[model samples]
Target: MPPISPNELSDEQRPFDEHVRQVMGGLRTPFTSTDESGALIGPFPVMLRFPGLARPLLEWFTTVTSGSVLSPRVREVAILTTGSRYGAAYELYSHSRIAAKIGLPDGVVAGLTAGQRPAGLTPEESVAHDVAAHLYTGAPLPGALYRSAVACFGECGTAELVFLIAQYAAISMVLNAYDVPLPPDAE
Candidate 1:
């Protein structure tokens, strides 16, 4: 789908667009949420196409991102794992940059994008990756892995990790379904 330029947005979409820009602007994102022409990028445009549903999802996204207790590295590991599993190009593109910007090594980012488990992860990062990898298999997280996650992250952090995985999985599906392309620079 072609991006809907800002000028073409309906009254209903305008507020949602503004909210998206506002939220994204406040985040330490490695990506540009709008293109050079000021169109919303990635799933933002797709969400704007359906404001009723997008509103709640955007709220959830805001809460997940702003209120999360997980470390940025853990969050990115789960996100990269989920995005790679779904082959969500934009998610992978954007988060890979975020991951690198946050100091994840090039090899590690390359491995995750390729859907392989890379070595050199700290114990915490390994647990995060394991949690996401297990979740991607569509089977229940194994008892051992669950215990490991909780042991490393505590009950609340473990729960947040799972939710993060689920959220990124949903985003991955949206990006893939819409065939959202990467920004021209990324390509």
Candidate 2:
């Protein structure tokens, strides 16, 4: 882990930190897009200031919980796929650990990180990776990709998968634009 801890921040964030800690009911890691990030990135929580970010994030949760396109394993795979294509250090740091926590085998995660989408992936997972790669690289999603996605996930699931990919791609943009380095010990 890099030296990204928020040292000297609590000294300035006493009240804000306390309020967030009480509300969130734990050691509130300061939202990186706001306040002092130590080494994370930016200031002003993306949602707290921008507000509109909540809509897509909520939709992402809803779509994932919809249990159509986003099995936990598949979800992690898609995240890793786009994170690599976009070079999203932040999402990679976060989701790599999550992939492990959600039970992705180490070998699979390692392979995906290298942009090799691995053999033996379920068809749906394979298409999700392909879609992510194409979208990141500025290619049109071919009909075959959409058809396979729909076949595996159905129409709604395909839509949700696209939504998730687009949302995370936007997030990757923010991080990359701002050079949002990873939080210390984050992965």
Candidate 1 regions with alpha-carbon error over 4 angstroms: none
> Candidate 1 lDDT, tens digit per residue, 43-156?
988899999988988888887777678889988988998899999999999999999999999999999989988997889899999999989999999999999999988998
| Candidate 2 C-alpha lDDT tens digits along 1-187 | 1222445334444334333334333323323323244322332233233335444453464445455546877777888898888887877776777777878788788888777878867777788888777788787789988888888878887787777788778777766766766654654
RMSD of 1: 1.0
Clash count of each predicted structure:
0, 3
Question: Which candidate has the top score in lDDT?
Answer: 1
Give each model's whole-structure lDDT. 0.90, 0.64
